[model samples]
Target: MDFLTITLPISGVAINPLLLVLLGVAVGVLGGFFGMGGAWMVTPALNIFGFPMPFAVGTDLCHMAGKSIISTRRHAKFGNVDVKLGLIMLSFDVVGIEIGARAVMLLERFGLAGLVIRWVYVVFLALIGSLIFYDFIKKRQMDKSGGDQSKSAITWHETLHKIKIPPMVNLPMAGVQCSLWLPATVGFMVGLLAGFLGIGGGLLMMPALVYLIGCPTYVAVGTDLFTIMLAGFYGAFTYGMKGRIELLAVVIMLAGAAPGAMIGTIATKYIRGYGIRLMFGATVVCAMVSVILKQMGQGGAASWVIMTAVTLMTAIVAIGMFKGAARELRERRLSHEPR
Candidate 1:
């Protein structure tokens, strides 16, 4: 058992040491590569194991903010980040997270905030999962037809560009001209979801940046992290000011994730971008399924039924991605070796 300090009136909390470190590592890897709010795993695991909702969310936000700051800087240094695109993304993403946060507060008044969040996860998860899955399946068809395709296709981005709305913004990095209203509306919608789910919304943000906002895959991810860094920092400060942040847990997780982030970043250099996207899509899809089953259990379904389903899915995915990344890394090294 590992224990970590919490805010006043709570003192400290105990958790499984190995699991905590593992959580940091898994989230670090995904966040480093995917620019997501891995709070899906952290908050749920924390809540299930006994941490209060607010504390779990608060601490995770702080950790995410810190890690994002580091990751965004690293990506920027590597020329993977587009500051102008990131700045543009920040406007909408921040508005979305803040609006999302406010919605969470409103849902709290109704009770069933957890259940509502689960449903939100189900909807967003299903929608994004379908979209990602379709992309790969479409890739196969395109390949079979002998059509050359870019590494990351932008059919959706092009479709969006055709909409001739007034006051369109030319996002050169994204290579799309979208209406100002488009970003604001998307941001507000995402923000409402974030508030309701009490999440950083990275899982949704990255995909949105790519498909909806029309940024290149690498640029979208880097920009998403830059945007999420803002959300996390703001969320953390707000929670801390309200006396909800858990310093001890944040300290412990960061201690583990700092090294893990270094490893994740190094691994990123070796791993193919497509590989990362597939795994990122798979992870969130699994998480989405998990949240769905959790909702099923809440609706009086057999707890084990939902538990078994989610557990199997999560385990298979997490392990598969880990092994796949390791194998890819090995293959990349071999290819670079002196013949």
Candidate 2:
């Protein structure tokens, strides 16, 4: 065990590199499938493993930027990305990230960074998780009653689209027409969270694109990954300049994340729509419970809960990909047979 431990040169903390690789692989799959950077899971996991909040955030952002680039490219090939919409959101996202980074730095100075960040994670995760589950349940009820199946239970995007503000823009890929400010506003808010939480903004941005910006589920996933890549680059740079990042950890994580990301992005082609939403909601709920446990001084339980959730989700996504691939091969073989 002692031979497995290595001290991070910058952070001066000894940790098992294998653990970092494992976290990377799990998050890479979840992030690619869910259209997030998986910072929500990694930051907490790193903190539980003994890294300070700031270092955990910085290293996570650095690792996320690289993984997101891979996921975004894969999504683009599937015609899932809306480039125009992603670029528009990027403009405002960077500014919000800067503000958030500053806020975290201030909290660190006061020795309240860890406490404040953990509490915020609990609150934010609760809201997002609840909304996703509620929407999933409502959609199931609609299916049973033979109501319109196309409409989601939460229609905030519809109302927002109807606002008719000036400078309306059309996103053909996303099949959306709305005020230009709509996505920019959403970007700023999500970016704020990214900076403060060390996330790539994908956690919030994916749902925001679907529920607040009117993008289709697949398009939202791709576009969110695009935005996450750019935001992650800026975040990594910001944290790096502040001497918060551990390059050794980032490199180790990327080793596992690369292959895991490919599996996740492909799984989306099979899972589709509400399936993604359901898994995402479950992931959030698990993360929230783990954070709550950590706050209650159950550190070992918190670690187990989060790691178990990540491993399970990764397996689910990988299984879906394999099954979908096999089915496709069978259909292709049948098509080739002389009729």
Best by lDDT: 2
Tens digits of per-residue lDDT for model 2 on 37-141?
888689888887789999999999899999998999999999999999999988888888889989999999999998998899889989999998899899899
Task: Tell me the tens digit of each residue's lDDT in model 1 across 1-339.
Answer: 225423333536656556556667666666777777578667766666567888888888888888887778777765667666556556766666676777777778998677777786788878888888777777768877887866455476666667777887766655656777666666666666665676677777777777776776776777777888887888899989988777766776777666656555555565556556676677667667666666666432333443344344434434555676788889999999999
Best by TM-score: 2
The worst-scoring run of ten residues by lDDT in candidate 1 lies at 299-308
Model 2 ranges with Cα > 4 A deviation: 1-17, 47-55, 98-117, 193-199
Score each candidate by Cα lDDT.
0.68, 0.89
Error in Å for residue 300 of model 1: 14
| Cα error of candidate 2 at position 304, Å | 1.7
Candidate 2 vs. true structure, TM-score: 0.87
Clashing pairs in 1: 96-191, 100-191, 100-192, 100-195, 101-195
